[model samples]
Structures are given as structure tokens and as C-alpha cells.
Target chain A: MNFDDAVRLTEILLGFAFAQQSIEHFKSFPNEQRLFIPRFVLAVLLMIGFQTAWVAGLLFLSGLAMLHRFQGPYNGGSDRMSLLVLFCLCLVYLAPTQRWQEIAFGYLALQLVFSYFFSGWVKIVNPEWRSGRALCDVFQFSVYPASESLRQWSKSPRVLFVMAWGVMVFELIFPLLLLSRISLVIALIVAAGFHFANACLFGLNRFFWIWISAYPSILWFQLRFITAN
Target chain B: MFHILKLLLPAVIPSWRFFDVIAPSPRIQFALLNSANAPSDNDYEWCEFRPRPAHLSFLQMLGRMFWNPERNESLFLVSCAERIVQQPTQHSEDEILKRIIAELKTNHSDSTGETTHLQFRLLLVQRQDSRLQQQVVFHSRIQSLSTQDKT
Candidate 1:
């Protein structure tokens, strides 16, 4: 994908994610609900590619206001990723030159890679996660389970162990996939499926949309930098 | 200036470490109090507020990606409870306490009219030795249910 195509796809995906998130905020306090109107409007403007630099800047500011309202991210990783994507988009559109835009966009791709790598690195170092105890505990006791029935997965220790290792290995090796276009495509597909399963099991629907929104940038980064090199 | 920076730090600096360590999850429980400032005997049983549903269909799960207000609100409550556990400040406690009271009033409208006061506690749930254990971490002082809440 070219840089412009990547930016457009990112905008569309982010627009949908932001719109969904805005609707979720309607269930919050009146002040919080008020913020969603402008957010939804900005998201629509972003998806339509109308005055993108201005839309991105306002959206970034709106995101900061939202963080202050919640005193932190309302939803942890997903909110952070959304803010990161907005920040990168702002840089991409507001940059003075195409070369600078590519650099800014590439930085976002780099951060996405680091997000997965760092998550895996932390888990691998923790004894609980390494032994599969963390996954077991998560399924057994975490408040995130979508339903009580989903917790049944905790009963199988062997399955949990293999799943734990599978996640760790995939995340640790994620950066290597960028070396080839086909490998990157396959890696992104697996990552999407992983997010889908988490959404189904934990009801972390926001993570799936926000993370997928950033995938186009990763594809563009691999094609432009990794393949070119 | 320092307070502003403190608020901005979380938004500006992203923490990607997710589920790296599975810690005990917090569950909020509430009990109704009688006019005597004590738990009413019949209403003494603490009930879990906003528990996850026992089951969800595949289509329901798929639809959650676009709209899931109940689950999002539940997650927000979890985040608030987590903050109270991690940082036991008056502000954090008050924030979540108010939310729980509001939720109880909304969800148990029929029971709220007769309930003059309420109290809530935070339970840290964890699995140990192949069994689930709940440890009470914080007990809130009795809070009055105002006329506004009853209405």
C-alpha cells in the first residue's frame, strides 16, 4: 500500500472506531455524553477526508479532553492506541513535506510493533505468565470475562499452557514478519483473529477496532521501509 | 501546573503492558442499611452489582464490537474499583461510592424507596489452590439514600 492509501484506510477504520466509542460514552455522565457529539462529528469529517489536518488536530485535542474527563483512559490499551493513531495522523497531515509525513507515519508503525513486543516481553519475564498461571487466573477470576461460561476454559491447564506460550511466541516474533510483504499480511491476519477472540471472550470490543485501525500503517511501513531496504 | 502535568502524563505516555501479570480482580458488593444505621436483617445479604451475564449469543457477541453500553459501563466500574484498590484516597473512594449508589438505585428501583441508607465494600477475587477466594479490601461508611435517589 502507498502512503496515501494507508492514511485513507487508517482514517476510515479510525472513524468507525471513534464513532462506536462515542456511542459508548453516551451511557456516561452528562458532561461526558456532551463530548461525544463533537467527537462523532470529527470522526465523520475524518472518514470523509475533509480538511484532514484540521480534523486530526481537533480530534487529538478532543482525545486529551476525554482523558482528563476520565482522569485516565476510559478503556486502557484501546484508548491509548486511538490517541496514538490520532497523534500520528496529525503529524502525517500537518507535516511540511511528503518525506516528513512518511517518517511520522512510520513512527506509528514502529510503536505498534513495540506495543506487541513489550507486552510479550513483560509476560515472558513474569513467572505467573510463563507458567500459564496468569492465563488460568485471568479466565478463572478476571472481571473481563464476557460470560460465566467462557471461564470454563480455565479448567484445562494443558490448553492454557500452550495458549500462553503461543501468544508469547507470536508477539515476540511479530517484528520479524515485517521483513516480507506476504509474512506481514499473514501476521496481521493472525493478530486480527487474536483480537477477535479476545473481544468474544473478554468483551474487549474496543481493542479489536482500534488495533485493526493501525494495521494499514504497519503494512505501509513494511512496504516502504523494510522492502525498500 | 504540576497537577495539569500529572493529568496529561497518562494520556501522553502510553503503557502497552496489558495482562502481563494477572492480579486479583475487584468486585463491588453493596448491602442496604436500616434506619438504625445497621444492615437490615432481611436485606443484609450483600449483592453483587452489575455482574456479567451468564450467557451471550454469538450474534450478541458480534454486535458488541459496534455497540455495548452495558459492558462498557461495567468496565468503567471495574476501572473505578481498581483505582480505589491501588490508591486508597478519599477522592477515589468517593467517586466510586457515588457511582455504586447511583447504579444500585437505578437497578433496584423497587427496593430503593424503602432503603434509607446503603453501604458498599470492595472484594479482591483471586484463584488459589484450585479454588476461588474473595478478600474484602475496603468497607465504605454508611451513606444515606437521599429523597432524590428514591424518586
Candidate 2:
């Protein structure tokens, strides 16, 4: 699909993800009383594909409140990704025309690109990450390790180094892959596998869905900026 | 400019300490031990009421969310524990532990109907070669609970 279609699809998926994460009463009943009502309303609007300015405004606020309510983003990357999508969608609905809406989507794409490059660059500069010890340590001491067998992979220095370097290179080169359709497709596949492994081994299920929701934005960016030419 | 800043600030800011730029060596783990000195694997066990949904299926995302060990409750407690450990002063440690004990007593009293002392401990866990090693870097003195705390 094209950029507009991609934006719409992402909004729908993000709405569902937010709804699932928020359905339970994470805060005490009295504490959540103010947030509970607005959140459900926002979820309903997004689910039904309604993107009015009011809805958007409420969603943007409720997303912030939910993150705050959860004691400031306990889920880490998933929280950040959700906020990015919510903020962009709010802008999309508030924009006066299709052109302006696309601009909002483009901003989301840039943020996603920056997130990948920033995370990878930091890892590259870190001594532990460069030595492959970071990946090994994660597997060994992970609180949510899926099984003992999974953690055993840390035993092999060669495997650890390759996997560590693989992650760093993939993330560092992620933005470059957006310039070509074939390369973007390959990168997307590799990225999906990476998230899948993380979800399975580390139980970071929310990260898997939230990050994938941002993929369409990158795809839209490529279509608008590169493939059209 | 305002709109742009709004979109960028949260994205640029690191939301969770775990997602910090630098992955430190020898990560930390938090554990709660009962007065009997036995460690319970379930963190929620100490909480008076474990949060659950109307239906288990709607709450369980792909049967994985429920099993996620890194629940927000524990993460929040860990953050609090980290702050307490950083000071390493008797007065500060006592203050933090007192606050934590009060929280536990308030939250975990009614449902469990069990009176037990609890201690919060932080473990410095590291991996070397094929083995994982851990030691208690910081541990709170046990906070004993009275039967009267069974609110």
C-alpha cells in the first residue's frame, strides 16, 4: 500500500496495541478514575477509524496519562513507540489537508529512523557492546529468560560476538536500507526476525508489536522520498 | 516549532533506565525475602491483591503478557530499591525500607492473610564464560510485621 494507506493501517494497529495494554486497571481504582474514562473513549475512536481533533487530543493526553500512570514507561521501548505513534496520529487528524497529514507521518518516520541509528551508535561506542559481552550478559542474567537452554548460548564467545555485531550493524545500517525497495524489504524481514527472537527469548512481547507498527512509517517514507523517483 | 518539539522530546528522552544508552556491566536484580529467609519466585505473592482482569484470556496477550517476568510492579520496586541502594547510608536505608514496608503492609495485608517479615535485597548478577554468578550487593534488615498489620 501507499503512504496514506500505511498511515491508516498503523493507526489501527497502534490503537489495538494501546487498548490491550490499557484494558486492565494498572493503577488503583481511585487513581485511575480520571484516566479510565478518557482512555476507553480514545480506544473506541481509534478502533472505529475516527480521527477527529477532539479524539486525537484526548488520545494524546490519555497516552501520556497511561504512561504516567504506569509509573513512567515500565515497558521501555514499547512505551516510547506508542507515544510516537499517538503523537503523530494526533497531528494527522489536526492537519488541515492530506499534504499536512503526510508531513506528520513523515515526522514519525524520521523519529523511527533516528531511534534505530541512535541506539546502534551508542552500542557501537560502548566497550561492553563492542566486545560482544553485552549480548552474552543479557542472555545469561536476563530476568525473563525463556529457558535455561536459551541462556546457554552465552557460553560461546564466537556466537556472542557475531550476534552482537549483527545487531549493531543491522541497526546502524537500518536507515540506509530505506532508500531502496529490495533492501528495505530484506531489512524489514531481518528486523522482524530480530524482534521475534527478542519476544520469544526475552518475553518483550510489547516491543515486538510496537516496533512493527512503526515499520509502515518507514515504508511510507521510502515510497514518498525515494521509490517515486 | 512547538509542535515539532512536542513530537521530538519524548522520543529523544530515555523513558526507562533499562533502555539507557550504556549497558553497564554486572546488571542488578531485586528480590524480596520473607522473614523465614526463603526467597519467593513470585513477586506478586507478597502483594495483598494481585491485579487480574475479568476474563483471563482478554488479559493474556498471546498467553505471554501474563507470564512476563518484568512486570511494571517489580520494575517500580526495583527503581525504588536502586535509589535506596545508591545512598548506602543507615538513615537513608532505614527511611527507604520503612517506606517500602509500609507500602507492602498496606498492599499485601488483606488478601494473603499471612503475617510475615520481609526484606528487600538487590543482587549484583554477572555472567562469565558459561556460568551466571550473583551476590547480594545490598540487602535491607528484615522488617518484621505484627499480626496487627493484617488489615
Candidate 3:
């Protein structure tokens, strides 16, 4: 993927994510509700790639305002990822040189890969995660489960163990996916599916969109360096 | 510069450590109290605030991907409660308490006759040895309650 294609793809995906988030914020804190209109407008402008640099800059500012309103991120990891993407996109547009733009987007892509690897690293180090106890606990007791019926999966320890290891191994080896085109496609698909399932079972819908928004940068990064090599 | 950095730090930095370990989940439970600063006899049982729905239709689940204000609000409350549990401070506690009271007032606007005060507690629920265990992590002092708009 060329740089422009990557940027466009990222913009479209991030726009959808931001638009949805703006609507969610309407039902959030009273102070935050005031931001919904600007955010929604910026999101639409972003999707259309209208005045790309200016729109991204304004969106970045809006994102910071949102951060201030919440005192941090209202939603933890998902909000963090969204901010990171916006920051990078802002730089991508405003950078004086193409090299700088590439560098900025590269940083975003690298962080995306590192996020998965680090998450898996931490989980593997924790005994509960390795023994599948963590997954069982999440299903049985975590407030994240979308419905009471979903908690029934906690009863099957064997299934939980397999699923837990499956997730950990996939995440741990995520960076390796960048080594080849075919592997990258498979990795993105698996990661999307993982996020999709989390949204379905845990009601973590935000994570699904925010994480997927960064995929274009990953695709661009791999094609630029790994495939060229 | 230092103050600006402190304000910006939480939003800019990403902590990718998600679900790294198993821990008990926090649940908010509140009880209605009578005028004497005690739980009313008739309302002795603590009701769970914003309990998760038992089920959602397939369409509702699909639609949530686009817009899910209620679930997001619930998650935000959980985040607030978790912060208080992790580090208790007057400000954090008071902030959550105020929000909880406001939510209760909005939801139970009809409770004007019997309940005059409200008390809430945080319960950490975890599974231990094939059974559920609940531990009270924090409890608040009884506060006056009124369904009438204070504004």
C-alpha cells in the first residue's frame, strides 16, 4: 500500500470510530455532551478527507479536550488507542516532509504491534493467565460479560484453557505476522475476529473499531520495510 | 511545564497491560435508609446498581457496535469505582458518591415517602474454588436523599 492509500484507509476507519464514540459521549457526562457536535462534525469531515491536515489537527485538539473532560480516558485501552491514532494522523498531515509523515505513521504501526506483544508478555508472566484461571475468572465474575448467559462458559475449564492459550500465543507472535504479506493478512483477520468476539461477549465495542483503525498503518509499514527486504 | 505534563500524561500514554491477571470485579450496591441515618427495615436488601441485563437480542447486540450509551455508562461507573478501590481519596470518593446519588435520584424518582437517605458500598466479586465470593471493599456514610430536583 502506498502512503496515501494507507492514510485514506486509516482516516476512514478512524472516522467511523470517532463518529460512534461521539454519539456514545452524548449519554456521558454533561460537560462531555457539549463536545459531541464538534466531534461528530470532525469525524464526518475526516471520513470524506476534506481539508485532511486541518481536520486531523482539529480532531486531535478535540480528543485532548475529551481527555480533559474525563480527567483521563473514559474508556481505558480503547480511548488510548484512539488518541494514539489521532495523534499520529495529525502528524502525518502536518509534517513538512513525506519522510516525517512516514516516520509518524511508522511509529503508530510499531506501537500497534508492541501493544499486542506486550499484552501477551504480561499475561504470560502472570500465573493466573497461564493456568487459564484468569479467563475463567473473567467469564465467571467480571462485569464485562455482556449477559448472564455468557457466564455459563466459565463452567468448561478445558475450553477456557485452550482459548486462553490460543489468545496468548497469537498475541505473543503478532509481530512475526509482519514478516510476510500472507501472514499479515491472516494476522489482521485473526486480530479483528478477536476484537469482534470481545465486543460480542464483553460489550467492548469501542476496542473493535479503534484497534481496526490502526491496521492500515500496519499494512503500510510491513509493505514498506518487510516486503521490500 | 511539569503541571502541563501531569495533565497530559494520562491521556497520551498507553498502558497496554489489559486483562493481564485475574482480579475480583467491583460491584456497586446501595440501600435505602430512613430518616434516622439507618437502613429502613423494609428495604434491608442492598440493590445492585445498574445490573447487567440477563439477555440481549441478536439485533440489539449487533446495534451496540454502532451505539451503546448505556453499556459505556456502566463501564465508566465501574472505572470510577475501581479507581476509588485502588486509591481512596476524598475527592474520588465524593465524586463517585455524587454520581451514584444522582443516578439513583433519576432512576428512583418515585421513592419520596419512605426513603430519606442512601448508603452505598463497593463489593468485589470473584470466583474461588468453584464458588462465588464477595468482599466489601468500600462503604459510604449515609447521605440525605431527595427525589425532588435539587437544581
lDDT of each: 0.83, 0.63, 0.83
Candidates ranked by DockQ: 1, 3, 2
Give the best candidate by lDDT.
1
Screening candidate 2 with a backbone cut-off below 3 angstroms (N, C-alpha, C), the clashing residue pairs are B48-B108
**A99-175, model 1: which lDDT tens digit per residue?**
99999898889988988888889999999898898998988899988999888988998999999999999999999
- What's model 3's lDDT at B28? 88
TM-score of candidate 3 chain B vs. the reference: 0.79
Candidate 2: TM-score of chain A is 0.86
- Across residues A1-229, which tens digit of lDDT does each residue of candidate 3 receive? 9999999999999999999988876655565677877898899999998997898888888877766555566787888888889989988877899999999999899989988998999999998898998898998899999998888999998999999999999999999888889999999999999998899888999999999999999999998978985
Residue-by-residue lDDT tens digits, candidate 2, A1-229: 6866887778777766666555544343455546755675677677677854566677777766655444345465676777778778778877899899889888888877777777788788888888887777776665445545666777887898998888888988988998789999899889878877776665577777777787888888888887887
TM-score, every prediction: 0.92, 0.71, 0.91
TM-score (chain A only) for the predictions, listed in order: 0.97, 0.86, 0.97
Q: Compute the lDDT of residue B103 as modeled in candidate 2.
A: 50
Model 2 interface root-mean-square deviation: 7.8
Candidate 1: count of backbone clashes, pairs at least 3 residues apart or interchain = 0
Residue B102, candidate 1: C-alpha displacement in angstroms: 3.7
Tens digits of per-residue lDDT, candidate 2, B1-151, equal 3544454476545432333232222223223444556554455243311222223232343466434532433334444445555656554344345545555556655632454665555655555555656665665665665422221
